[model samples]
Target: MVGQAQAVAAPRHHEQSHLRGLVEVAGASVLWGTGGLALQLIREHEPMSPITISAWRMATAAVVLLLALLALRRGPELVHLARTRPRQLLVVGVGTAAYQGFYFVSVTQVGVAVSTVVSLGLAPVLLTVVESVRQRRAPTPGRLAVLATALLGLVLVSVAGHASSTGPDPVLGVVLAVASGTTYALTALAGGSISRETSPLVLTSGMTLVGAAVLLPLLAVVDGPRVSADPVALAWLAYLGVLTMALAYVLLYSGLRVVAPSTAVTASLVEPVTAAVVAAVVLSESLGPAAVAGIVLVLLAVAGLGRPSAAAGPVLPDPGR
Candidate 1:
């Protein structure tokens, strides 16, 4: 009876832990969903180029995270990560910068909603394929079906007439968005793998520092390098750096420690929905019928993932346990 009771408790505990990881990943996505909108708000006051904005975002996040690590007397961990996993950290840092750079540039060409959808929506597909290849198995039919549903929704959001019209160059924007998604997928895999042995806070600090170092020099490439002086715009940039970059990523890496990279990215599909809704309410942007339907499908797909299915076999075991 004691052994049976222990066995019963173990699976229950595992399920609860998995659920917490999902919530953390989803929460991070919600914060990230606000990013494009915040960037848009900053542009309204300063008209900074996307590259300049990207540099600032990374630099700001790096500073804040480093300071926090020092405050906690965890500064040595950053050095340890740099010395031990230099290659992996560089990949994550450069990958993070590249993805955000592509995404911000895409926003200039495509507007907020479509750029957000195309970039974020594409990550799960790429990551899922990567996972399947790594695991040496095909995704179960149920997993494939869920992926298909999510992709269809993404397609709708991307091509809807009203959604496309907001961008000056939708085609170029989409190309950049794809670039963003691909880089994002690679970064997620690297970070997720590394998080298994590292603290999320330390990992995030090291990555952001590398990201900032890589992006800072690119500011010169911006046409004018317009830095915002407005208090409100500065505040918005702080929000982007602190909330979206630092906090969101901490949550993300934490989730990745327990959740499979593919599933973690899938759960983050909530980002586009959050972005679309924020755009509609704050920017008065219209989502149209198809776009609305697409949001619903994406939400349903996320819900489907939360439940047990054949795909459950692919889920990474809870690493912390």
Candidate 2:
């Protein structure tokens, strides 16, 4: 009787853990979605260059993460990353920094909804290709079909969004958004390797610090003397540094402990959707029928990727984690 009782409790415990992880992952996605809204607010006031905003965001995130690491006495773990995974760490750092810098610039030029849709909608396809190449196997026909559909959807979204826009250079915006997606793909690939050896918190903190260091000189050279913006803008920036970038990773990493990596990645497709909804509600951005269809197609593509495949090999590790 006791054995059966214990067995019954075991499943409950596992279910509880899974539920907690799902909640954490959902929270992380929420934080990430808020980042898009925050960036939109930041762009409205004084025109701080995207490079400048990126530099400051990195610097601020590094400080917050570093302090948390120190408080936890995990400074040695971060130092060990430099010694053991120097090259990988550097690549991750640079890729992460470039992704942020370019993404901010792209969002500023193209508006958050279109920029996020293009960048994130295309990231899974890039990841699928990278995983196939890394494993020395070809992606299955189903995966390819999904990729083609997603790409077509992305094109539709971009065309629909651009047809009505008059604010910035559409060509330049597309280039920057694509660049952001490429760097984001690289960062995701790098994170897969790092998460195998290091704690996600340690790796994330170290990379944020390294990225901030790389961006510091550019901040000074490009933005000139930094001046304090309005209190509201600063508050949003603080929310971004603390909640979106730093705490979001913590939640994501914790969630990955219980959830399948593929599920976690697919769940985060919510971030872009959240951004779109927020943009529509807040900015009164109109989405035509084609754009709405594109969004659904992109979501379906992500859902297809979320399923584990024998041909796709092992799931890629969660970069946001």
Best by lDDT: 1
Question: What is the TM-score (0 to 1) of candidate 2?
Answer: 0.75
Q: Which clashing pairs does model 1 show? A: none
Q: What is the TM-score of each candidate against the true structure?
A: 0.90, 0.75
lDDT of 2 by residue, 35-150 (tens): 76786687676466667666777777889988988999999999998899999889888888887777777776777556766676567666776667766988777766656666
- Tens-place lDDT per residue, model 1, 234-276, is 9998999999989999999998887777778887877777777
Instruction: Please give the distance, in angstroms, between residue 294's alpha carbon in candidate 2 and its true position after superposition.
Output: 2.6
Runs off by more than 4 Å, candidate 2: 1-30, 104-122, 156-158, 166-178, 223-225, 250-270, 310-313, 316-321
Which 10 residues in a row give candidate 1 its minimum summed lDDT? 307-316
Residue 54 lDDT, candidate 2, scale 0-100: 65
CA lDDT of each prediction against the hidden true structure? 0.82, 0.69
